[model samples]
Target: MTAVIYKSKYGSTKRYAEWLAEALGADLLVRESVRAERLRQYDTLIYGGGIYAGGIAGISLLKNCFPAAEGQRLAVFAVGAAPETPESRKALLSKNFTPAMAEAPLFMLRGAMDFGKMTLKDRMMMNLMKKMLDKKPEEEREEWEKNLMSLWGRASDWCDPANLQPILNWAEN
Candidate 1:
């Protein structure tokens, strides 16, 4: 059996987890609701969570539950607003995961962003980021900074079934 465990703050990671669970005929679990002991029952464990401030939300749960997974196949996926790029993906992986965890098949998936739906804390943080980016010269601003400025105040969804294909193929093998 397979288990799809996820934690999502704004629903994008949950959306991906739901689709992946259906595709693999796996059980779905919220990170907070899952016990480390419970993960022992699954042959494959897939973890998904949203990325915030360069960290994967709820990742501590994965680190704690990992020991119980033992010899099971493990995969991790991260959802974020930033466009998928090799450099960004590498940096995110390097910052968030240990070498062992990093060995698992990992996927970086694009997620939706709606400023209107964000919590006050997130709103303030984004606004602060926008201000800092605005202060930088145009030539010094990164591509993501430019994208964030362009997409500010606008809601967008980049989630797609196609994005789950690589993860699916990795799990099947």
Candidate 2:
């Protein structure tokens, strides 16, 4: 049996976890609710978390409990507002995991971002980022900067059922 565990700050990662759990007919849990010893019950473990400032939130769930999951098949998925591309995915995985952890099958899922939904700290950080980007020449602005600027103050959901297919397929195999 498979178990899905996730951490979501702004609902996007949680939404993906819910869809994946339903599709796989797997047990679902929030990261905070899971205990390390309890993870041994499942043969397959699917962990998902939201991305913030190039880090995956609540990844400690995997890092801290991996020993208990020794015999389990593990998969990790990351939800982010950034556009999905091989380069970005590779960079994210590289930045977030060690070589051993990076060897696990990693998947990237697009997530929604709403400035209003963000905490004051996140809003301030984003505003700071925007200001920094604004100082850059238009030609030097990266794709992400353009997207972030455009999405400010707006809510968008890129969560799709199809996006879970790759993870589902990997788990079944």
| Best candidate (score: lDDT) | 1
The TM-scores of all predictions, comma-separated, are 0.94, 0.92
7-118, model 1: which lDDT tens digit per residue? 9999999999999999999999999998788889988889998999988888887676565646888888999998878788888788777765767877899999999999
Tens-digit lDDT track for model 2 on 1-173? 89999999888899999999999999999999888888899999899999888888888777766746566888899999888777778777877776547557889998998887789999999899888988988788778778877777789888898999999999989
Whole-model Cα lDDT of every candidate shown, in order: 0.88, 0.86
- Locate the minimum summed-lDDT window of 10 residues in model 1: 61-70
Instruction: List candidate 2 stretches off by more than 4 Å.
Output: 67-69
Candidate 1 overall lDDT versus native = 0.88
Worst 10 residues of 2 by lDDT: 95-104
